[model samples]
Target chain A: MSAAGGSNPEYVIARVRARRSALFGDEEYRKLVRMGPAEIARFMEESEYEAEINALGSRYSGVDLIEYGLNHNMAKQFNDILDWADGRLYDLIARYLRKFDAWNVKTIIRGIYSETPRDEIETDLIRAGEFDDRLISRLLDAAEIEEVVELLSGTIFADGLEAAYDDYEDVGVLVPLENAVDRAFYEQLLDGLVVGEETKQYREFLEAEIDFRNARNALRIARSGADLDPTDYFIEGGTLFRAAELAALATNPDELVSKIRDSRYGDRLSNALSDLEEADSLIGFERALDAALLEYADTLGYVFPLSVTPIISYILAKEREVDNIRAIARGREAGLPPEEIEEELVIQ
Target chain B: MIEAIEPLMTALQSEAASGPAISPSAAAALAVGLAAFGAGYAERGIGSAAMGAIAEDEDLFVNGLILTVLPETLVILALVVVFLV
Candidate 1:
C-alpha cells in the first residue's frame, strides 16, 4: 500500500470490478428484510460472507454474529484493495480510507471516556485504515484519553488533538476532542489533491460529500434550536456555503431549504428538500441524501473506467451494503415490520 | 563542421549511387521487429489485467490466458511483410 512506484490502476480496477458485481442488490435486501437475525446470518453464510461467518461463527451468534461478520468482511475487502493498489492509486485510496482511522480514534476515545472494556472497544474497530496493527494495539492499551492523544503524536491528528486537548481540560467535555478529530480528517481529505482531468469528477464528488455534510449539520443545529455557532461545525472545501453564510442560514430552516433548492445539487436533492419542508422528521431527508450520493458515485465510476472513482464507488456501495444488512438485522431483532425496515435502507 | 561534413556527404552520395544501404528484406525484418515491440507493449497492460481477473476467479484463467495473447496477432500479421519481401 506504500506509494513508491507507478500506479497500476488497470490491475486494481479489474479486480475491483469483479468484486463490485458480487455485491448484494435490492432483491437481497428485500428478502433479508423479512428474515430473522439468524436467518439473515445463515443467508450471509451462503454468499461472499461465507468465510467470515464460518471464522467468527463460534465467537458470536445471532445479530452479533452478523454485525461482526459484516465488519470483518468490510475490513478484509478494503484491505485487499489497499494491497492491490500501488503508487498514486495507493495514495489516493489510502487518503479516503483514513476516515476509518478517524473513526477508530473516536471510538477508542469514547470507549475510554465511558470506561468500556478493552475487548469490547477492540471488537468495534474496523481495521481498514493505513495505521498498522501495532499502532492500533498500542492505542487500545492506553489507559487515558491524554495517553491516546499523546500516542497519536506524529500523525495528521496530532496538531489538532494537541490544540483541542486544552479545551478538553477547560470544559471537561469530549466534544472538543471529537470535533478536532473530525475536522482534522475532513481538512486533510482535500488537502493537496492534484485535480487533473481524470480526478476532476472525483474532486467534485468529494465537494458534494462535504456540502451534504455541512447541510446536514446546519439542519441539525437549526432543528435543535441550540445556542451554538454553526461555524464550529463548518467544514472547508465545499462550494455550498461559506462559514459566515452557514452560520446565518443555520438560524432559518426555510431559507436554508430554499438555498439548497437553488444550488447545483438542487435538482438531485429536490425531493429530499421538499420532504424536509413538509415532514418534521430528518430521517427521510437523510436517507434521500445517502441514496443521491450513492447514485452519483455509481455514475462517476462509468464515466472514467480506469480512475480511482470506480474503486471508491465500490467502497461506498460495500459500506452501504454493510449498513443496510446491519439495519435489517437490528430492525428484525427489534421486532419492527418489514415495511419499516425497508424504509430504513438506502438502495439505489 | 561544414568542411568536415563535405567529405562524408560525398562518400554517402557515392554509396547511395551504387545501391541502397539496406536490402528490402532487411527493412521488412525491421518492420516486424517494431511490430513485435508494439504488440509486447500492448500486452503489458492486458496481461496484468488478465492476471488480476484470474486471481479473483479461477474459472477466468482460460479467458485471461486467451485475452492476454490476443495482441500476438499483431506480430503475426507483420510476418506477412517478410513473405512479401
Candidate 2:
C-alpha cells in the first residue's frame, strides 16, 4: 500500500492470480444466462459479489440491484488493486484506471448538461480512478459545465476540455466535450511510458486499444454517412491510421476494411472483419474487437508473470466479468432469448 | 604509501607462496554465506508472494509457508561444504 517503497509485483501478482481464479468462467456464464435477474442476485450473493449484493439488496431490486452490485464490486476490487500496488506499479495501474476518471467527468458533464439529478449521477460515477472522493464530490456539486471543466483544471483533461468548451458553445452539442475527454484519456494513455522489455507488450496493447477506438470511430462515421470530419475524432498513439488517412478512409467502408485486413491485426480480426461484411452492423465487430483485446491481454500476462501485464490482465478480465454479467442481467430482464444474450457476451 | 606498505607486501607475498590466500574452511564459510545470501534474496520474492496468497485465502498458509522456504534448500546444500572442508 505504500507508494513510496519499491514495487511489490510479487505480492500483487500473487493476490491477483488468486482473485483471477475466482472470476466467472464459461460454465458460470452459461448458467447465469439462464437465470432471471432475481435468481442472478441470489447466485451472485454466493460468489465474489456477495458483499456488494447484500449491501445494496434492501435498497434496489431486480436488474438495478444486479447492475449496482456489479458496479460497486468492480469499483471495490479495482480500488483494492490500486491500494495494493506501490511505486511504479501504482503509476502504471493508475494510468489505465484513470479512464474511470474520464468516464466520471464525462458523466458529470452530461448530467449537468441534461439537468439530471445529482444523486442519479452520483450512482453512475465509478470511483475506481485516481481521483479521490473529495474531488468527485466537488465535481458532482458543479452546477455548470464550465465549473466541471474548472474543477478538472489541474488534471490531464484540463487543456483539451478548455479548448472543446468553445466548440461546445458554438455547436450546442455534447459531442465536442465528450470527444475532448476521450482524446485526453487516449493521449495520456501512452504519455511518457517507459518502454522496457516487459512494458513493450503493454505498450503494444495500449496502442492496439487506441487503434481499435480510432477504427471504431471511423467505421461509425462511415456507416452513419454523416458529414462529420473523422479527423476531429482521430485519437493519436494508434499506428493503424493517421488522422488524414482516417479522414480519407471514413468515406469508404470497403477500403477501410481492406486497410485493416492488411495490417498486423488483420489475422486476429479476420473473422470479425468478415462478420462486419456479412452483418452490415458494427456491433458484432466491436464485440469481437473487445474479445480479441481481452484474449491478447490474457496471453501477455503469462509471457511476463512478474510484470504489470498480469495485473492489467486481471483488470481487463474483471471489467469483462462486470460487463458480461450486466449484459446478461439486462438481457434477461428484457426477456431476450438466451441465444441472443449469449451473443452479447464477449467471452474468450 | 608504497614505501610504508613495502614490508607488509613482502609478508603477504611470503604467505602467498606457502599457502592459499584464504584457508579451505574460510573459503567454505564464504561459500555458505554467499549461498545463504542467494537463498535470502530468492526468499524475499517468494515470501512476499506467499504472504499475498495467504492474505487472500487463509487455507493457503501452509502452501505459502512451504513455497517460501523451498529456496532454503540452497543454504542446506551449501552447508555440506562446511563438513567437506
Highest DockQ: give the candidate number: 2
Instruction: Return the lDDT, model 2, position A277.
Output: 93
Task: Write one digit per residue (lDDT tens) for candidate 1, span A1-348.
Answer: 113433378789889989989999989988999999999999999999999999999999999999999999999999999998887888788878899999999999999999999999999999998888999999999999999999999998999999999999999999999999988888888899988878888888888888989999999999998899999989999999999999999999899999999999999989988888888779888888888889878798787788889999999999999999999999999999999999888886
**Per-residue alpha-carbon lDDT of candidate 2 for residues A1-348, written as tens digits (9 for 90 to 100):** 223554399999999999999999999999999999999999999999999999999999999999999999989989999999888888889989999999999999999999999999998989999899999999999999999999999999999999999999998999999999999999999999988888898999999999999999999999998999999898999999998999999999999999999998999999999999988869889988898898787787877889899999999999999999999999999999999999888886
Candidate 1 segments exceeding 4 Å error: A1-7, B1-11
For candidate 2, please provide the TM-score of chain A on its own: 0.97
* Residue pairs whose backbone atoms clash in candidate 1: none
Model 1, CA-based lDDT: 0.91
Candidate 1's clash total is 0
Clashing pairs in 2: none
Q: Which candidate number maximizes lDDT?
A: 2
Q: Please give the CA lDDT of all the candidate structures.
A: 0.91, 0.92
Question: How many clashing pairs per prediction, in order?
Answer: 0, 0
Worst 10 residues of 2 chain A by lDDT: A1-10
